[model samples]
Target: MHIVVCIKQVPDSAQIRVHPVTNTIMRQGVPAIVNPYDLFALEEALRLKDKFGGKVTMLCMGPPQAEDALKKCISFGADDAVLVTDRSFAGADTLATSYALAAAIRQIGKEQKVDIVFTGKQTIDGDTAQVGPGIAKRLGLQLLTYVSRIADLDLEKDTITVERRAEGGVQVLQTAVPCLITMLEGTNEMRFAPLENMIHAARYPVRKWNKEAAGIEDVTKIGLKGSPTVVSKVFGPTPRAEKALMQSVEDATPRDVSLNVIQKIFTQHPTLERDILAKASV
Candidate 1:
């Protein structure tokens, strides 16, 4: 079982700031961390590799600085890491990003037959949730998104079963090998790296491929040219002027305080009483 896990290095959203004049993200001072959702995919891939005794390759398409994120994956027991970086890949949207990734995966498949590809449901910076499906379309791979659990794998039969998180409940679906899976968040916990693996990861030389080296032949199919969507503006949510009113019940009993709080809420939102009554009647 050869598994490829796609990951991204994203700015820590908690530290992100919006520029006052340009209304753009101020990434200058923000720290870069691996996307949290991708961690779940990586952990799931690692678990499969551990059980199957196969290789797990970490792949990422980002700037040169993104190699740091791939190194983190190496520390977690991934057998190899590949970083696809080039200036032409700048300002790429989901379509171009998926195209480049699919080409690179084809290159990786040349060296070792790839059985599965794993990705996060979405990237925090983009949050479009289109890249995984795009890659599947480009590669003609069966796509399973929002996967909550990998139930079974039959390497001998070349099939896999997974529990997908759907609206209201879970869906159990089976698919063949050479498929793409977008893991759901909170599906699994990331494992801690051992001291030996950490030391090796610190010294590991990750493979870096340029646009041409990664098998991108069409110049127009990558980078800003291939990206049709453009971000016209980025703005933060406006701050509300009024603050919430604090209700104190130091002298009242718990029951009285609860009633008072409920009354206050109903008074603030006049429709709440009617809404509650409607639900109760139903």
Candidate 2:
């Protein structure tokens, strides 16, 4: 019942800034924190560990500074932490990242059998929600996304059940061991690290691995070379010159105000009325 949880160190979105000239993110002054969404995945894994008495390993692919993020997970009860960092992995897109992470997981599997892999639904910076599924695809693991709850687990039978969040409701799913799960945020809260664990995390020797150590066999499948997706530019949304129209209902009855707003909308967008009528008739 060994679980591996993937996390990333990302810039605080509230404090992040974009360079006007280069149209790139300015990370120089921004504080890096563990991806908030990943915390949910970590908490879920920790909860399982508490219930089943297994090991939780924290894995991250980033610069040397990302060791801090792994250490934080250690304080939260992860048994081991591994950092996969290399210059060759720089500028990796989600595809390349998944490739590298999959390689690292393979290496970790050699040390210990991994029953489950956990990740956040999406990272705040990327927000693509692709890496977890990509890793699952590369590793041929059962991929479950947007998981809201873990309903049951049977170690002897190697079966697990979960509730997945979907369009309008939750979907109950059952899968076997060696599966990948992307946990939905707000499903669980991270626990506070006790003093002993905090001390242990501070002294923990987090293992660092380069591309070679991470079991990456192909040089052409990592970093900028392997990244096919190109970002042409990154810029903030343009500000609209017009302000929002404010309608006052203080002097009018609710029905009268509703009718007035409806009339205005119909007058401004004549086709909207026809579209609504058409849909209603169907």
Writing each residue's lDDT as its tens digit, candidate 1 over 1-282 gives 899999999999989988887777778989999999999999999999889889999999998989999999999989999999999999899999999999999999999999999999898988988999999999999999999999999999999999999999999999999999999999899999999998999998999999988999788989999999988876767767897665567777889889988999899898989999999999
* Model 2 CA deviation exceeding 4 Å by range: 19-22, 238-282
The lDDT of each candidate is: 0.93, 0.95
Candidate 1: where is the Cα deviation over 4 Å? 20-22, 237-282
Highest TM-score scorer? 1
Collision pairs in model 1:
none
Error of 1 at 4 (Å): 0.5
TM-score of each: 0.86, 0.85
lDDT of each residue in 1-282, candidate 2, tens digit only: 899999999988989878887767878889889999999999999999999998999999999999999999999999999999999999999999999999999999999999999999999988999999999999999999999999999999999999999999999999998899999999998999999999999999999999999999998999999899988875777757997666678888889889989999999999999999999999
